[model samples]
Every structure is written in C-alpha cells, then in structure tokens.
Target chain A: MVFSKEVKSVRTQTWIGIMSVASLVAIAGIFLKVAMSTQPREENYENITKPGYAIRRKYFWALLIVSVVCLVISVISFPYPAIMEAKITGEPVVVKATGFQFGWELDKDVLPVGKPVRFDVTAKDVNHGFGIYYHGKDGSLKKGIFVAQTQAMPDYINKLYVTFKDPGVYRIWCLEYCGAAHHIMTYEFRVE
Target chain B: MDVADRSMYERRVSGIALGYGAITLVLFGVTVFFGVIMRTSQGEFISVRPDVLYEFMTLHSIGAGGSLMAGVMAVMWYTLRKHLDMSMNIMQVVFGIIGAAVVTIVAVTLLGYYGTGWTFLYPLPFKSAGAWYDFAPGMWLLALMCVIFAFAMSWIDVIRAASKKYGFSNAMGWTLISGTAKPENVPPPVVLISTVTAACGLLSLVAGFIVVSLMLIHWANPSYYLDYLFIKNLIYYFGHIVMNMIMYMCAAIVYELMPIYANRPWKSNKIVAISWNSAFVAVTLAYWHHLLQDFPQPLIFQFLGVFGSYMAAFPATVVTITGTLILIYKSGMKWKVAPLYMYLGLMGWAIGGFWAVMDAGFNQAVHNTMYVPSHFHTYLLVGAAFIFVGGLYHITEELGGCRDTFEDKLGLWTWFVGGYGFVLWFMISGVLGTPRRYAVQMPGTEIYSTAAVYFAWTVVFGLLIAIARYLTRLQSVKPLRG
Candidate 1:
C-alpha cells in the first residue's frame, strides 16, 4: 500500500480544504468584527432607579480573543459561552396583609403597633399577590416571584414601605392557586 | 380500483401513520405525566429539583410539540396520498420521520438548558448555567440538519407530485395565490392550505438554520450577544411561523379528510386556498406581536404584527365555520364519535383561533397574560389533538387494525371528553387569572384554587377514562388484525 494509502485526489481535496478554510476565515472575520465592534458597557446595577437593568463589565474583546485563539488551536474544539450575571439590589418588596382565607403570619407571629422592623415576604408555595392594602401609599400589590422562571425573577422581591397605623390582626393567604389545600393555606399575624 | 395496488399503497401509508400515531400516543402520555410533575412541583422543591423540573419541562414541550407535529405529518401524508392522489417518494417520507426524530432529540436536549419553552431567547442561552445543563451547540446543529434535510426532501417530493398532476397555475396554485376559493369554482382549499403551510415550513427551516447557526456562534463566543439582536429577530419569525405552520397543517388534515366521512367533498376551494395563503404571508410579518409583549423591537413592526395576527384567523374561521356548517346542516348525517370528534376539533380550532385573533387587540394585550396561551393551547392540544385522533380512527382499518368494540368507542369518547375537559379547565383558569406553569398559587388572592380543584378532579377522571380506553384498544388489537 502507498505510504499515504493512495493520497486523496489533490484538486478535489485542495478545493474542499480551501473552501472550508475560506469559509472559516470569513466566519472568524465576522466574529472578530462583532467582538471588536464595541465593548458592552457594564450594566450599572447600582442605578437604583432601574431595578432589573444590569450593567456588566466590558469583556467582549477578551471573549473575542479567546474564541479566535481557540479556533486557531482547534477548529473542532467546542466553545462554551461565558456566564454573565448582573447583581440586582434595592428591589422593591411587597408584604401582603390580607386576602388569605385564614390570614397572614409573621415570622415572629406578632408585632407591637409601634414596632419598627423590616420583614421579607415570600410565597410558601405557588405565587400569592400580596401588599398592604392602603390608600396613596402606592398600594401596589406584589406578585410572587416564581424562582427559576426568568419572567418572575424581577417580581420575586418587592420592597414594601409601610407603617402599621392601627392595632389589629392581619390575615394572608396564597393568592394564585397552589392546590387542594390552597384555600386552607392561610395564617394570621397580630399587631398591638 | 385495483385491490392490490390500493392495498399496497394503503398499507404502506397506514403503516407509517400508525407508527407515527403510536409514538405520538406515548409522547402524549409522557407530556401529561411530566406536566403533572411540572405543575405539582411549583413553589415546592424536591431533591434533584431543578433538574427534575428541567426534565419535566423538556419532555413536556417536546412531547407536546413533537407528538403533534408527527400527528400532523402522518394525517397530512395520509390525506394527500389517498384522498388527493398525490404520490410521494417512500424514501422522502422516511427521511421526514428521521428529521422529526432528530429534532425531538435536539428539542429535548435544549430543554435541559430549560431554555424556558420553545421560543428559547438568545442572550439567555449563555446567561444561565441551569439552562445549559451540559447541552452542546452541536446537538442543536445536528438536529437542525436532520429537520432541514427532511423538510427539503419532502418539499421536493410535494412539488414534484403536485406539479405532475396540476401545473403551476392549477387550482392548487390559485389557493396559494388568491387565498380560499370554492372547490368547484377554484382549486381544493385543503390542498392549497397544506401546500402553503408546507411552504412556510420550508421558509422556517431557512430561518431556523440561520438562528441555530447564530446560536452556535454565540456559544462559541459570548461577545456575540452584542451583535445587535440579530438572532433574536430571526427566532421570533422562525418560531411563530413554524408554530402557525403546524396549526395550519392540522387544519389542512381536517379540511380535507373529514369530508370523506361526511360524504361531502371540499368546496369553495379557491377562496379557502387564497385565505390560507394570505394568512401564511400575513403571519410571516406578524411574529413581532410577541416582541411587543417584551424586549426592544420597533413599534412599527409590532403594529404591522398585530394586523398580520388577525389575518391568520380569517382563513381559520372561513374554513371551520363554512366546512362544518355544510357538513352538519346540508348533509344529513348520523352522529358517530369519530365525526363528532372531528366537529369538536373544528370547534376547538375555531374557538382558539378566535381567541388568538381577539387577543391581538392593542387594549386587550394585557389580559392575554395566561389566557392567551390557554386559548391557543385549546387549538394546539384539543383541536389538533382531536384531528390526530380522528385520523388514527380513520386509518384503523388500513393499519391492519380497527376500533369496532363498544369499549373502544367509549375509550375514544373518553379521549374526547378528557382532552376537552382538561383544555377547557386549563383555559378557564387562565381567564380567572391563574398564571400558567406556577408550581403553586397562593391561597386566596385568586379564584384558581377553586378552579384547580375542578381541574384536578377532571384530570383524574379523564386519566382513568384514557387508561381504560387504551387498555381496551390494546386487547382488541388482536381481533382487529384478523
């Protein structure tokens, strides 16, 4: 047998190799152009005004260099995209006071009328629309954050600005729809 | 008709249809079970929680989407080969199945990334780790290749077959050209709709390939997200149009196939065809409506999209109302479960089509939240599901099988009632403001809890009915073969 096992047809092989190389080069050029075009401005998460808008660090050029280097090193080598997370803070929180069949429960179970403390409210199961029902305090109802669902991530944490005006027991319940015991999934918290 | 020739062709087509239907049945079962898990696990976490959630979601989407797609293909092929006298290459048909299978696998893999349903948004593909779940871009590309190849081959065969029988200017062409018209006066509306839908599928393949390729590029280089929402734009058009194509394909099956049972051939061919083609072209521009729901796409495109959205329903309504009324009123007919199922399917399609069209109203967009999908799912699941069932029923004899027993009838009815009840309950919950895919809803803020009780009971009853019917059918398979 020939040392090269009858080397493949030169013209056909050369054409395919050239074509592939040209295609790859074209693709690389386009990629580099995109990567070098403009570094993505770091999303300014500290801009408390916009809750979910994240400004990530400009790493597009770095990523581009790595991708190009990989392509040159091994065309068959798969490229794993980098994970970019924008930390969101100062998001609004909503605490539901009522609409629960049985009513709302506090972690401490009760609070004095004048007590000042911060409470983070979350749905035990399913999403419950909750927020203090008051006039002009921007009585916006907070929808539960569906963890893992990107759509619900923003709505997950809502900040509540409220002060108990009177002494009473407030009730909260799961609002959206959990299951068979959903109606019974309620609790009461008292302020005095 | 030559008995051998008819039997040979019939047997082959039926064989393929049966195989497709059987696989579809299994997929449906998988989807329902996984759907229960996905639904039940909301707000609650089990060990392997995210992974399980991912698994359930992946299988659920693929099972629902892929099974329906296969059902559409099987029925469309059966209708064309038998009713329309359109002969396709056997190899091409097999290739189409292979493509679907490959796509199913790719779809499942993508689900691991839990890409958040079929319209996997671009930037997210690399943003989240749970989303990737060890899935590579190669799988997606391979699957894409399979589907494109399959559709390309099928497209070739359809052109060859239809062209051989009728020229480019044939009535079939008129349906695509002018929209829906009278059969006697124009071309067969069903054929026209099917052809146009297939054409859309071809176009979608192009877009899908481009989008998938872009996704691969993004995977290779994270910086590609800065590339100006290029992939995002392609996906909206590709995903929406492909979905419409699937729906149109199911509609095509019923429009053509239901007539045989009713003893009425399709009429108003040119009008119907023209309506579908118009719908097809209009929908190509309409996908931007989804964009208006979120993200930054041009407002003008959204305006055009809203208008285009309505165009799809015009054909849907014209075909459904006119066809069903003719079948029921003009033609004196006895009520059988199969034909009843077809009518029910028509109702579902019409209702869903109406809701989808209605939801496009600018003011009405807010209320579309969960209800829109509920309304649309009625068409996707019940409408399309019933047609698939009807096709299966029709092909029973040809599949070397038949559902002759009273139990089988009961089982078929069970499928009908169960499917309808499930979808109706699901849709009603949406209307009541129960968000879709919530692991759990809070106790009292919404009425969905009450609806959930009803929904759960309905599902249980429906599941029992389905199991009984499936068992009965399994037992009777032997007798039907003889």
Candidate 2:
C-alpha cells in the first residue's frame, strides 16, 4: 500500500536518491567542520557536556521503533518474486536446455510462439548463466538486451518461466562464469 | 613475565603484524594491476586472449577479497594483542594456514589454470568441461576452505580473549542495551569486534560447512546432487559475509584509534551499542538482498533483505560517522596522515553504504548490473581499505618511533586522489549502465573503462609512494631473534 503511488511499484530509487543527497550533505558538513575547527597543541575542551541517561534511553527506543516500522511495512506488502507472482495459467511448452562450458543444447532449435515455453535449464558440464537475450541492429552481444533467464547449474534443474508473445530470434548466453570460454557460451533459437 | 620479556614479546608480535600486513599489501597491488588490465581489455583499449582475461579475472576477484581479509585481520590482531593477552601459537597457526592457502590458490589460478571465477558458483566447479584440469576445482575449494577455517579460528581467538576480559555478556555490549551496566564500563572495541567475530564466525560456519560438504560430496560420488538455490545462497552469503566483515573489522580499528588523534573518547553509548547490535542483524539478513533477482528466492526473505540492507546504514552514521563527527566537533584535531585517512575512510564508508542501499532494491536490481561491483569497490577500496591503511600508518609511526615526514604526505595524497579517481570512473560507468563482469563491453562503456585504467596507474604511483615511506619507517626496527 505504501508503494501505491502513481508508478504502482515501490519507487526504491527515489528513496535511495534522497538518502544519497543526505549522505553527501552529512559528509560535507563533517569534513568542513573538521577542517575549520581550531587545531591546538593540546586538548582544550574540558568537561564537554554529555546527555542525561533519559535522553539516551529515549533515542534507543526511537531507533527500535523506527526499525520495527520499516520491517513491518516491508513485511505487510511483500509480494512474491516476479516469476512466482505471474505463474502461467495454462500448460506451457516444455523445453530442455542444457548448458555446457562453451555452448547450449535445447530440445529444439526453433520454438513455436503463442504457447508459453517452460525451459528446464540444466548444465551438462559446468554451471552457466542461461540469459535469453535479443540482439539489436548491431548484431553484437554487446547490444544484446536481456529477455528472461535463470542459472543453469549442473546436477540441478532451474525451471525458467517464460512466454514469448512475438516472433523473433533469441540467444541463450551464459551469464555465470564457468571457464575460459564462458563468454562464448551461447545458443540461438528462433521463435516462430 | 618480566617487563623485559613482555616488551620483547610485544616487539615480536609487532614485527609479525608489520610483516603480514606488508604481504597483503603486495597481494593487493598485484590484484589491482590485473584488475586494470582486465578493465582495459574489456574496454577494448587493448586485446588479450579470452582464456587469459578470465584467468586474470578469477585471480583478481579472489585475490583482492582474500588478501584484504588477511591484511585487516593482522592489523586488528596486532592492536588487540597489545591490549590483552593472545596465544602466540594461535597467531602462528593462522599465519601458516594463510601462507598455505594463498600459495595453493595462486598456484591453481595462474599455473593450473583454474578459471571458474571466485564464486566457483556451484556445479561450475564440478563441470569445468575440459577448460580447466579436473582436480583444479576441488583444489580451489579446499584452498578456500583453508582460508575460511583460518579466519574463523582467528575470530574465535579474538572472541575468547575479549569475552574473558569483559565477561562474555558485557563483551557483546548487551548489558549496555539491557541497561544492566553503564556504557563506559565496556570498551567500544570489545563490543564492535565481539559482535563482528561472533556473527561472522556463526554465519561463516553455515556457509563454509554447506559449501565444503556439498563440494566434497561431488568430488567423492560425482553422482550426488545439491539444490541450485541452496548452493547459490551459501556461496553468495559466504562471500557477502566476508566482504561485510572487512568493513566491520576495519571500522573496529577506526573506532578505537581515531579518537586518540582527535582527543575524544569514543565511549560505548546506548546509540552506539544499539546501532552495532542492529548491524549484526542487518549484515546477516542483508545476504538475502543479493539473491533478490533470483526467481526462486522466497518473497518474505526479499522483503527482509530490503529491510536488512537499509538497517546497516544506521550504524554507519549514528555510530561510526556521527560518532567521529561529534568526536572531532570543534575539538582541536591534529590532522595527521593516519587520522586524515580515517576521516576520509568514514566518508568512503558512508558514500559506499548509500550506493549499496540503492542497489539493494529488487526493482533497482536491473540497474545493479554494473553498480554492484562499483558499490562494493567504492566501499572496499576507499572505505575499509582507507581505515586499515590509516591504521597501518598509525602502527608504523607509533612502533617505529618516527615523526610524520614530508614523504608521508606524498604517500597520503597520491593514494587518496588516485584511488578516488579510479573509483569515480567505475561509478560513472555504473550510472551509464555499463554492465560488469562482462569479458567485453559495448561501445558506450569504453570511455569510462578506459578512464579507469589511467586512474589505476595513478593508484599504482600512490602505492609506490606509500611503500617507500613504510619501508623507510620499518628500516629502523631491529630484526627479530629466534
């Protein structure tokens, strides 16, 4: 409910931005104060005031309450991760994708569009990141944009949730570093 | 022990601290050089073989993280031992294990060609697919296990020594929180180090045990299975905790030492104690934040991660930064080279913590592609590294009975300017959304990456200056006798 503003999603960036500004301000203030403060040969500020125990106690409680509030707000509105939240309603086309150190092997090279394709990603030789990307006009992985992906670890199957709505060629590139050829680990599949 | 014997023993330990800290500094230098090489390669300013780049990648990652750990531990232990009695035998054991671990790790990466990257991620280590030798992964894992065990042992010793001095309850500053004892009764160093040692010890056990056990099983049977998500959490947490602990450990040094320069007593107060206690929880739960983008991670944990990540920032200011600020407030600060680093180190910690909190969000995870590495580098390089280097400057100056020299200023400014410049480029690239860990980057990323390389050279110059100063200072000390 707290993130129920115009964006519909929690604007975490705004909060971070505010915090960043505050941080810069605090740092600058401290640095200036330190730079400007009188430098003496010996310590001179005798019997600097210390707060009463009561004020300290109040601060302790205030911090505790603030922490509790933050925790509560986050807890109450916590949504399932994206994949979990948008579980496919109908049966999906199953695809078995195997990741090797340098390449990928899918059940089929071309995937049929319109049906949700559920990829059971597994690594044959080593762990590789199975990031599905679509290349831009430059035709370089450098220009490749991410679509959907999951880590392909050996001896483990990661069921990646995806449903391609449009016809296009996509590439499965290893995201996690496996070895020398990790960057070269890629497989292209056509969605028609 | 007689005063003469005690002083001799203290001198011996001081020599060991200087020796170990120097080794770590060397290791840091090597890794930073390789890091520049990789950045330049990725930026396409120069061309290198793919395998070679990756080999350097793997080495640089682990080398930086691991060496920093060993380096800071020695600095902290040296300071700690001066205050209370510690087992010299235990120190020797730690030194031996670290020596063995670093040798094995460097050998496997450079000589044996283990290039799976430091996370070793999981299944990747088991299935190198002929890129690396079969046994190399196992050896790397064993090396990591050795380092983990050694560090854990060191922490255990610190905890035991501290608890004994303060009675275990007061050691953690819990009595301050409970209001059973006055805050002044317990030293702030004990509270900070005790909390970090205990938390890191327990969490490291969880991570180390799970990972090494799973890894051993794979080595033994090759048919045995482990869950992907489980292994991911374990390895990530292990790495995260270690990185997080570096901040805590070095901050411990700052809290204890900085006030000495500023002429203020950093007493363990309600806010300070509470902030740190909160940090203990925050650092642990913050691990889940790293896994937020993973589809399989639980929803509540993701929320907890958000909360935890934010919680960590509290101590950064309320305890460490503000505490320093208040300590230095209008008090005549000496502004020595060592204390200057400490002050900047606090600035680094605050700035880096802010960047980290920004990147921790699930929505912002996309933006974190490059920002993650930048945030961490900012914290580690400028933040924790500064505090620690400052501490070293303090220790060397104090023990060597030397005065601050013009040479010290040269070392100080160069390191500061060059280090900050390099990190600035990284953050700039992050803001521009240049993805990290990519062997190669897009055209748009080249400028920032190229700039980083130039600044890196500046850092090297600074390091050379620092090394020269330290060497001159250390030259006065007599060699330790057997």
Candidate 3:
C-alpha cells in the first residue's frame, strides 16, 4: 500500500511538472517567434490595428469567461465554508491550538479517525503558521507535504478543518517564519 | 517647452537616471548573492546557523525590494520628464533618503541581527524570541519610515506636476474615458500609467506609514495594544501595492520605449484609458489575495481577492502585451538588446501572472509555500528586472551613444537561461509542497535546493558579465549633443 501511494504521488508530480513546462515552452515560443520577426517597411497601420483589435476583443472575452469559470469552481472547493459550518453546528471535535515562537500547544493530543477535527488556531506571542504534516510510524514528518494550514495570528482565531481517514501519527509545523528557531517549531499528535 | 530647454532637461534627468541605474544594478547583484547564500544554506552546502540564515533572508528581501523600487522610480521619473516638468530637486531628495535607508537596513539586519521577515508583521518584530537586539526592530522601522516618506514625496511631486501640465483628470485618462477630450488630446500611455501608479502608490505609502508608525509606537509603549488582524491587513496592503507598483512603473517604461523601437504610436485610446483606470482599482483590491490564508479575514474580502487578482491581469494582457506584440509585428524593428529584453520581459510578466493568478485562487494549496516565491521571482526577477535593465540599456544607447557588443548579447542569453532555470526549480519545489523561508529543509526537499544553487551561480555569472559590459560602455560614453 505504501509503495502504491508513493507511485501515485510521483505520477502526480511528474504530470504537473510536464504540463507546466509545456505551457511555458509554448508561451515562450510564441513570443520568441514574434521577437525574431522583422517588420515590413510598407506595412499599413490600419491593417494591423483593425485585425489586432478584433483578435483582442475575442481574447478578452475568452479570458473573462475562463477566469470566471475558474473562480466559481475554486470558490466551490474552498475549505472555509465547511470549516465555518462545522464551527456553527459543533459537529467536529474542537482542538485549541496556540502557537508560540518555537512551539505549538494543542489542547488535545489525540483525535478520532474518519471524523472532522476543527483546529481553532491562534498565536500566543506573534504570528505563526498552523501547518499539519503527515507523519510516518518512525516518528518523522512524511516528505514535507502539508496536510492543511492557516495563519495563527496573535489575538485571532483561524479555524482550520481536517478529516483523517486512516489512523496514524501526525505532526504540526509552523509554516510561517516566526523566529530563528522556526524550523524546530513542531508538535506531534495521534489520530486513532 | 523650447527645444533647447527640453534637451537640457533630458540630459539632466538621463544623467541622474544613469547614476541611479548603476547603483541599483550593484544593489541587485548584492541581493542575488544573498539569495544564493540562503539557498546554499538550505542545501546544506554551507553550514550557517538558523539565525544567520534568517538574517540573510531579511537582508535579501530588503535589498531586492529597495533596489527595484528605487531603480523603477528613476526610470519613471526619466520617462515622465519628456512630457511634464517634474522637479529634479525632489528626485535628488528621494535618492538621498533611499541611500540612507539602504545603509540603515544593512546595519540593522547584519549587525543587529534583525531576523524578522521584510513583511515585519506586527508583534513579531517586537517579540523576536531573543534572536535580535531590542533596538533592531525600532531602527528597522525608522529606516522603513524614511523609505516610505521618500516614495510618498516622489508620488506627490509626480501628481502635482502632472496635474499642472495636463489636468489631473486628463493625466489619469479619465477625460479620454469619459469622451470629454478628443483622442488626439489624450495623454501618452506613459503619462496615463504613471498617474494611476502614483495615485495608488501614494495611497499604499500612506498605509505603510500608518502601519510602521503603529509598530514604532508599540515598540516604545508595550502597554499599547493593537489588532493583529488589522495590522496584518495593513502590512499586506502596503507591501502588495508597492510590489505591484514596481511592475506598473515598468509598464510605463515599456509603453514609452516600445513605440520608439517599433516606430509606431502606442497611443491612449478610450479602451487603453479604461483598462488603466480599471487597473488602478484592481491592483488596490488585489492585496486581499495576500491575506487569503488568514481565515479570520472577511469572506467578502477573500472573494474580492480572487476577483481582483483575475481583473489585475486584464489591462496587461488586453492592452499592453497585445499592443506591444502588434506594434512590433510587422514594423521591421531591429532586434537590439533593448527591444529583446523588453520583449522577453513582457513575456515573463505574462507567464508569471498566470502562475500568480493560480496561486491566488488556490491559496489553500500553496499559501506560504515555495510557490509564492516561485511566482513572485518569476515576475520580479525575470519580469521587472528585465524591463528595468532594458530601459537602462535604451537610455544608455540613446543619450550616451553606448552600443551593444557580442559579449553583451551572450551575457543576456546566459542570464535568461540561468534565471529561468533558477525559478523553475523554485516552481517545481512549490508544486511538491515545500514551504518557503525554512533554514533547514524537510527531509526530501533539500535536493531541489541543492540543484537550484548551481542555477543561482549561473545567474550571478551572467549578471557579472552584463555589469562588466555596462561599465565598459559607461567609461566610453560621451555627453549628449542636441
């Protein structure tokens, strides 16, 4: 099972890497072609402006439609509404998390698997990041992938909701740069 | 303005700009070196203490931002002088303040060990966890106050001068948009952009001044309490707007220079006018995107963040990028270093914008990750830096009669390859979920940092060659003749 999950992760990374590279290359190539082109001395301004405006109109509309669609889709996937709803309904286990310069103090060290956990995260002294990382059985963070996170600002509570499907150990690391020892600002917990 | 007066004005402004550009380029080189040091520390190639690494990170941010802001301000001032009689005395004052701030920032970060990130989020600077001296944060804030005051002074002068030359409304292209003015009577594209940039920049500077003053007050009086979320919002607002203004200032330069190279008029029509006016609003609201991860932020503002981020791209894509491509398409323009850098710079801006919009929308996945820096470095390092360098080369060749050589061309290509390669690693690491600003990397993430170090060195080597070329030309430059 571990091997299979690793394979899946690698596949996803490779796919994203290839897609990003391809998009950048395609964009760069188009710009390079235009850059290398020599303008004709006899070109007419009218000929260029007319078609250019026409194409620009189409491009503008296309961008608008695509961006709006993405916005709606992303908004739907946002974790805020669920977290807010969980807070109002009191359906999830509430874990109070307070971050300091080099540590996180959680009210609860254990949570239930297959149930929602609401982390009411805030900072005691300064701003820190409440980043949850998956932990391996050997007591180390797993490959640095953040499971979820929210800012832990002093005097403010940022609610982050997460559900652990499988029973395992997990770790919390400060994602924001708070101090010199920020890297060591980690806390461990169990979800059973 | 008479012909002789205009020529004299050009010479004076260009000389100041050339000097400022040289200083900025040198600062940029130092910042790049600092960046390499941070990366190498993360890669475990050098064993620096974590506190030392944070110090370098702080300096890197301050130096790069200061250099870019000061450099682009000079570029805008030089370009705007063609149309408006901006005060050279004010420009000198701005330069002096920035120079002093740079020195203070270096001392505070390196000597006093002020490791609070450049954002200098409230309470963090005061509660330094014993990593830095108590006086460091105060000194840092004081220096920042000076920088903001300088920028504020510059913007006030730009607005006052522009309003005098062309009515404020006309300068902002509002008259063109409202059809109160004829198309031929419209301000040039640079004027329109500079006015909008100045207005937004001045507003952001006010926010910066307020926030820094509040922090300074808190530093002095520990009993005085402030709202953390409100302060965070203000910080990001000021930081985000100032950063965006750097790009907009470069856009102003492009609008002015691209036309001369293409031998075409890139005028401010109704559409161009409307685009920039909307940009002014979009850029202001887009700061909300930086606060997206702060869940306590209002939901309405979060939604606006996404919307504003999307809208911010409209002006650049619809007007500036497309217009430049179309202008040069069949104009039989030469592929000089200036045009080449400007062309690639625009391309970088577009590419970086795509990634930025993605990150802004999907903050849950990438907020504070290396992805944040990935997108910014793409835009700032490759996008704004290229534009500024191109502007400098353009002015140097035009006013000082400096010519590009084979070595200059080779150096540019090297910089291009190394820069893209360096940022590519950052992008990949971001995708892999590596968090940014970590002195010690996670177990599996150090590999990317190790690989990035080579690319960083390549970039430094390329930049050194470019600087050498620039200096060689500078020594041979003759005075401008009418």
Best by TM-score: 3
lDDT of 3 by residue, B43-130 (tens): 8899889999999999998889789889988988888888888899899999999999999999999999999878898888989878
How far in Å is the alpha carbon of B355 misplaced in model 2? 1.4
Question: Given candidate 1, what's the lDDT at residue A11?
Answer: 26
Off by over 4 Å in 2: A1-100, A104-125, A130-173, A186-192, B1-4, B182-185, B190-192, B442-444, B478-482
DockQ of each: 0.01, 0.29, 0.60
Which 10 consecutive residues of model 3 chain B have the lowest summed lDDT? B473-482
Off by over 4 Å in 1: A1-192, B1-8, B43-51, B83-115, B134-138, B175-187, B225-228, B362-368, B397-404, B412-421, B428-435, B440-450, B453-482
Per-candidate chain B TM: 0.83, 0.95, 0.97
* TM-score of the first chain alone, every candidate: 0.31, 0.58, 0.81
**Considering TM-score, where higher is better, how would the candidates rank from best to worst?**
3, 2, 1
> Model 3 — TM-score against the truth?
0.95
- Output the chain A TM-score of model 3: 0.81
Residues B92-146, model 1: lDDT tens digits: 4654656566455646564544333454555444444333543544465456556
